[model samples]
Target: MDDIFHFDTLLAGPPDQLLKAQEQERQRIAADLHDALGPLLTLIRLELGRASELVREDDLSDLAVVIGRAHGHVAQAFDELRRTVVNLRPAMLDDLGILPTLGWLVREFERCGSGLRIRTDFAVTEQAVPSHLKITIFRICQEALNNIVRHAQASHAALSLTLTDESLCLAIDDDGCGMPDNSHRGRGPAGGTSSIPQRATSSGGRCDITSGPGLGTRIHVCWPLAGIRP
Candidate 1:
């Protein structure tokens, strides 16, 4: 028989690492939006208010142009907020399960003005994964796709999930530029491809990445389900 199961031993360090990385990312985004863009937006609003007063007095012919520029800046700020929110946590992933969440991510990426083609080939059995595990898998998928979009410059990508008698395996493949020669395994201060393996290990699993220059990248994560009730 296999060894007895215990959460303390099974999920020792990786989840905590992931949580820390996520928090750091949140802080960075908050500082960028609140600290950097926030003041600029406030100033723009003040200028817009002053321009409005000038327009009411019919004293400034250029007021409309100033207002137009301010409006454009506001639009840009809103766009930045949207990007930051999506990066921090995809709203759909919280609302839906992994499958639908992944679908939503793919759609968002296609609409991201990046023109990358994403294909999915998942075969998960709808078994109820633990909440933490679910979140980890979702994030791993998100990071993998982001890497493909940001670095791979690849035209296509694929994702697959399968469950067997003993374990569950998920594979993400991309036809993009591969990792650099010196790339190492571990989550960076800002979560990236390195975090996937850590996430997998924390879930009593293992993750592997295979890639080379001009070749596609493939990430495989496997979690043992021998003692899991679900």
Candidate 2:
């Protein structure tokens, strides 16, 4: 049994090799979308606009109209494509770091007209959190807000990220309709049950969810920053 266990462990290679490969793939795809596809879309839009400009609207009304409609479709496609690229890997997260990216995310959620007012209090500087943990922290917060938008029919929400001597904590609170009685006993919200908590726990962190019928829901996550990275 011990020999078999050693052989299986050997087959697995370094545990981190798989994680490294995944991250590398993510980076490659993100770069291709941002650097290649984004510019190609812009070029197509410009070419269409230029083609339309060449045909005088008075002389070629029908052709111009066709080109204009095509331009509109291209515009919509470009916007959606940009959103997809952002979802895949937000440039703000890479350029601005986690705090600003989070603030931007809140503003975006508020813009959705979900009738949910979001307030943010990010007390920790980006330097305080280790680089490796920032993506996990951001993703957990993102998933939490997504749950609120989808499940919590709330009016007001608060997002706070604070760093203490012991840990870096993120808390999301919503004054929404809250969860069912069984939800408290269950894992989490339907879609987020695994993604949110597993992300925290995998990083040597912990997550807590407090919710009740008509009482709203609060999600708290804390990551002990010390010794998390080599």
Q: What is the C-alpha lDDT of each candidate?
A: 0.69, 0.70
* Tens digit per residue, CA lDDT, model 2, 108-217: 89898888899999899988878888888777777778878888888889999998998888888888776666423324432234355555665767677666667777
Give the lDDT of residue 63 in candidate 2.
Answer: 64
Worst 10 residues of 2 by lDDT: 1-10
> How many clashing residue pairs, candidate 1?
0
Quality of model 2 by C-alpha lDDT:
0.70
Quote the lDDT for 225 in model 1: 83
Q: In candidate 1, residue 169 scores what lDDT?
A: 79
lDDT of 1 by residue, 1-230 (tens): 11111122233344677677667767877788887578769868887888979978987988878887888888878888887877766676667767787778788887887888888877774454555677677878887887778778888888887887778878888877665443333532112435566667756677766665566677877777864322
